[model samples]
Target: MALEWLVINAGLSLPEGFLAYLPSLDYLHDVQASASSLSAYISPAVKASLFILGVVASLINASVIPSSLGGPGNAVLEVQAHRGGLGHRTENSLWAFAHAMEMGVSILEMDTVFTKDGVPVVWHDHDISPEKCRGDFVGAYIANLTLAEVKSLSCDGQLAEHPQAKIYQDARIPTLEEVLDLIECYDNKMVTINLETKLDPLAPNETLPVEKYIDDIVPLLERRGFASRTTIQSFDWRTLIGIKKKFPKTVIVALVELETLMSINGEYPWLGGLNLADFNDNWIAAAASIGAEIVSPGHGFPWTDTIHTPGYEPFVNEDMVKRAHEYNMRIIPWTADDEATIAKLIDDGVDGIMSNYPQRVMWVGREKNRYVPRVGTKHRPHCLVNA
Candidate 1:
């Protein structure tokens, strides 16, 4: 009887009524026959029908099966080298960018701070942290400090303890121009760049005006033909908006966090900012409202309160990725370093990720058959030998 059902579904050569009494059938041996006998019994029309059915089913499976359903190979994890492959070399150095290229990352992520002379330099923080730099205050802003004065301070800091800290030896700060040049040298491979504009409009004594900074960077990108390869990102929504207004062709990514937005209603109006909720409960909507092409949120946002906080549910969930996709936005979470967490993000359907160690992203890519972009091509101080 079971054989009858198989024959029906398999479109095999059999009596049309053979499956009608399948529920009551007892002995399976009744249908058993030699292969030659069965082949002789199959009519040419039935054989053709069965073959056609198999082909139709195959096409249906191929068309209906989600491209992402077939194991990890279908997943595309775009690797953005945060701080220019910080795991390989010093953060934001030319060496780091070059190394990222060699590793074949999807994007090169770096921070930018303007010099006093309105020159955009590739450095991570406005005020160097005690962790990355062991030094006195260089001044309030990068725009206030000359490139020479900025270079005098040690860019390397205690990334690890003692012997493990050998990576922090001779890493020097790199200018934004130098970083852009390095990226161009790679012939603009698989890598796109996410340039964070660290300029705070609320801060006092702005060294580089918004318009001036735009003027300085846009032409350089146009000349290098990297205007399309570049993405302007900023926590400051206004800056992103400005970039959009100025360069409609270039991609602009709006960066948001739960912290600063919550503080916007505070005593100092300047410190207060736009909350994510204000944009219709969707960060993508907010970005789109300002003509942004991409939406870049931190890892575990609105899910994990602290960076180390465990039990991230929605932040790394499929639902979040689906929602972002529904909005026609790509989910590229920032600075997620853990390998397991990164894999989870890929499985959750994120479009890409920003990682300090692009190598880990590349390893996952190789295992999953995803392509990682290559970067890092410039001279750097001794500490960046690995970079």
Candidate 2:
């Protein structure tokens, strides 16, 4: 009753299935006693919250969180370093990942594309753009080059656009294996790796098959013993659906953009063949259909980058978060770097955020008294140096 009443107090709607998991009386009593602090934030529910993401992902299925764990005031948003904190270093480079980890980001979010020899390389664009890379490898598709050839390219060159981005002195695009090895080098067991598959359903030929992603990544994560802390996210929902059924240990995230969520190729293959209208046009519902533990939507109108135009309307709001919570799914919106946007997201009750700057999130998290991950000591890990 107290849990039910408290949900009402928070002005959060109860889904039809909300009754399936009610808090025990002991937890209810704690909530009653801490009514003062309960008003501060949903203290007791933090047990089953997205704080639940890191700890409970292995214990539960993708769709439902059957119970709560502890008293409230414990919900902490995971600060995900988008493209390995690209605002600070070259996006998805070892320098960026290490720096972001050093700053105590809970998650290092990076993108991955396959090489010609079927090796998975950490990169965003399928075709290496001259904008981020230099040397002979420029303008070549990542899939067409071997891992050795891909390594010869330099991604540390700063462009006029990323004026504030710090150069890492000839940083190379590290492989997925190298990234996992670096995490081991840091010795930070609590940190999670949110890796995205750079597979474009619109242009499938540009990248390897979805099976290769599943085959390559799952085994590699298992082999590295990082399976428990790894989150595999993709705009293509096919991987999410497959990963859940095959590699149940890995946390699957449904990454939605304004474009992916909209119909494409006269159908919705991007969404694992499900249309928006299938679930009353709900992104969270559509995500849940494919067994996603977290539903990550784009920040606003454009839904691609963090930059907002004049009078930009947001795709994420309180209602979106509430609906996600009702379905027992976590909401961690992508690419919100500004202090105001981060604060508003926290206020809206998002589970976490993806950002290009870790310091900004850390400052806001501290100011708001939200739990940020433990700070990592700086290190030039063996993986980055040898590579």
lDDT of 2 at 227: 77
lDDT (C-alpha, whole model) for all candidates: 0.60, 0.73
**Each candidate: RMSD:** 16.0, 10.6
Residue-level lDDT tens digits of model 1 in 56-158: 5433432232212222223556778888777777778776777776555667898887888766788866766667764455444677777776776676765
lDDT of 2 at 221: 82
Give candidate 2's total backbone clashes.
Answer: 4
> Where does candidate 2 have its weakest 10-residue lDDT segment?
63-72
Q: Please write out the lDDT profile of model 2 over residues 32-88, one tens digit for every residue.
A: 222222244655565345333422342242212211121111276678899988888
lDDT of 2 at 304: 39
Q: Kindly state the number of residue pairs that clash in model 1.
A: 20
In terms of lDDT, the poorest run of 10 residues in model 1 is: 65-74
Q: What is the lDDT of residue 135 in candidate 1?
A: 48
User: Global CA lDDT of candidate 2, please?
Assistant: 0.73
User: For all candidates, what are the clash counts?
Assistant: 20, 4
